[model samples]
Target: MKALLSSRPVLWFLFLFNLVVAAVAPFAVDGTQGLVTAAGMGAVSLGAGAGLLRGHGQGA
Candidate 1:
């Protein structure tokens, strides 16, 4: 588990894939619900994932 998480290539793949999820999230549901889902859930997860990927690079 840690091995894959610490791998640069795997991290990059996950980061990019998360962006796809964020893009589609805005249309996964109806009306304001979908927008909320995208901004709240999707964006939060994206921020955390980005931090994880970048943290490793900056030696955090």
Candidate 2:
């Protein structure tokens, strides 16, 4: 779990995925759909960050 979380490629993939989602979100939909898109992206970003932070603490 720690190794996976600390992996650079995994982190980059998540970052890129979030970027793509965020970039497409505004133009791909509207109203509730837009809100949902934003929320989903936010959740992914938050989860990745939280996991990395937790893993970093454990590693030290």
Candidate 3:
């Protein structure tokens, strides 16, 4: 588990993929529902995922 967490490629992939989904998902829908989901996903990826990525890079 620690080994996997330390893997840069895997961490980067997870980070970028979630970010992409957050960016593109809003456009995939046409109503307030889409906007709400996008906001939630964006917060998770840009907020939480960013913290993970930063901690990983800093070896925290």
Candidate 4:
């Protein structure tokens, strides 16, 4: 369970999930824009994935 929680796949999954939520946030609001938020979330996810990949390499 600990291994699964710390896995890169899990990290990536969470990041992607956040991105998806950000993308859909605009529709939830009456007049809010979601593109910028989505873009920011995407950037964060990309960075997280990259960081996880790098950490995995160092451990192996």
Candidate 5:
């Protein structure tokens, strides 16, 4: 778990995936659908950032 959490590649992949989702969310839907999609994308980014911050301060 520590090894995976510390990996830069995994973090980068998550960041890129969230970015792509946010980019496409507006055009792919409307009304509540677009709002929900955008919220989900934001949540993923916030969660990933929080996880990275927490992992950085963790000690063995």
Candidate 6:
């Protein structure tokens, strides 16, 4: 379980999911607020992924 959590593939999958969210949010939700919220979420996800990559197996 610890190994899986630190896997690069998992991080890539998360990034890809965020990309999809960025693409779909505009059409699925109305108003600028949704986009801003999604962008904020994306930034957090990106930061998390970066941290995981930087720390590598440290957390595990």
Please state every model's RMSD to the true fold in angstroms.
3.8, 3.4, 3.3, 4.1, 3.3, 3.9
Could you tell me which 10 consecutive residues in candidate 3 have the lowest summed lDDT?
51-60
Regions of candidate 3 where Cα sits further than 4 Å from its true position: 1-10, 56-60
When 1 and 3 are scored with TM-score, the better candidate is: 3
Per-residue CA lDDT of candidate 5, range 1-60, in tens?
967855656766776688678778878887788878878887786777766777786664
Q: Go through the candidates in order and give each one's C-alpha lDDT.
A: 0.67, 0.72, 0.70, 0.70, 0.74, 0.73
Backbone collision count in every prediction?
0, 0, 0, 0, 0, 0
How far off is residue 33 in model 1, in Å? 5.6
True-structure lDDT of candidate 2: 0.72
What lDDT is reached at residue 18 by model 3?
70
Per-residue lDDT of candidate 3, residues 1-60 (tens digit):
967854666666666777787788788987887788777777766654665656764653
Best model number under lDDT: 5
lDDT of 1 by residue, 1-60 (tens): 987675666666666676676678777887887777667756655765776756665642
lDDT tens digits, residue span 8-45, model 4: 77877867887676777677644535666766777877
TM-score between candidate 2 and the true structure: 0.59
Candidates arranged by lDDT, highest first = 5, 6, 2, 4, 3, 1
Best to worst by TM-score, what's the order? Answer: 5, 2, 3, 6, 4, 1
User: Which candidate should be chosen as best, given TM-score against the real structure?
Assistant: 5
In model 2, the Cα lDDT at residue 14 comes to: 77
Clashes by residue pair, model 1: none
Q: What TM-scores do the predictions have?
A: 0.52, 0.59, 0.57, 0.52, 0.61, 0.56
The TM-score obtained by model 5 is 0.61
* Minimal lDDT window, size 10, model 2: 51-60
Candidate 4 Cα deviation (angstroms), residue 34? 0.8
Q: Given candidate 1, what's the lDDT at residue 4? A: 68
Q: Residue 18 of candidate 1: its Cα lDDT?
A: 66
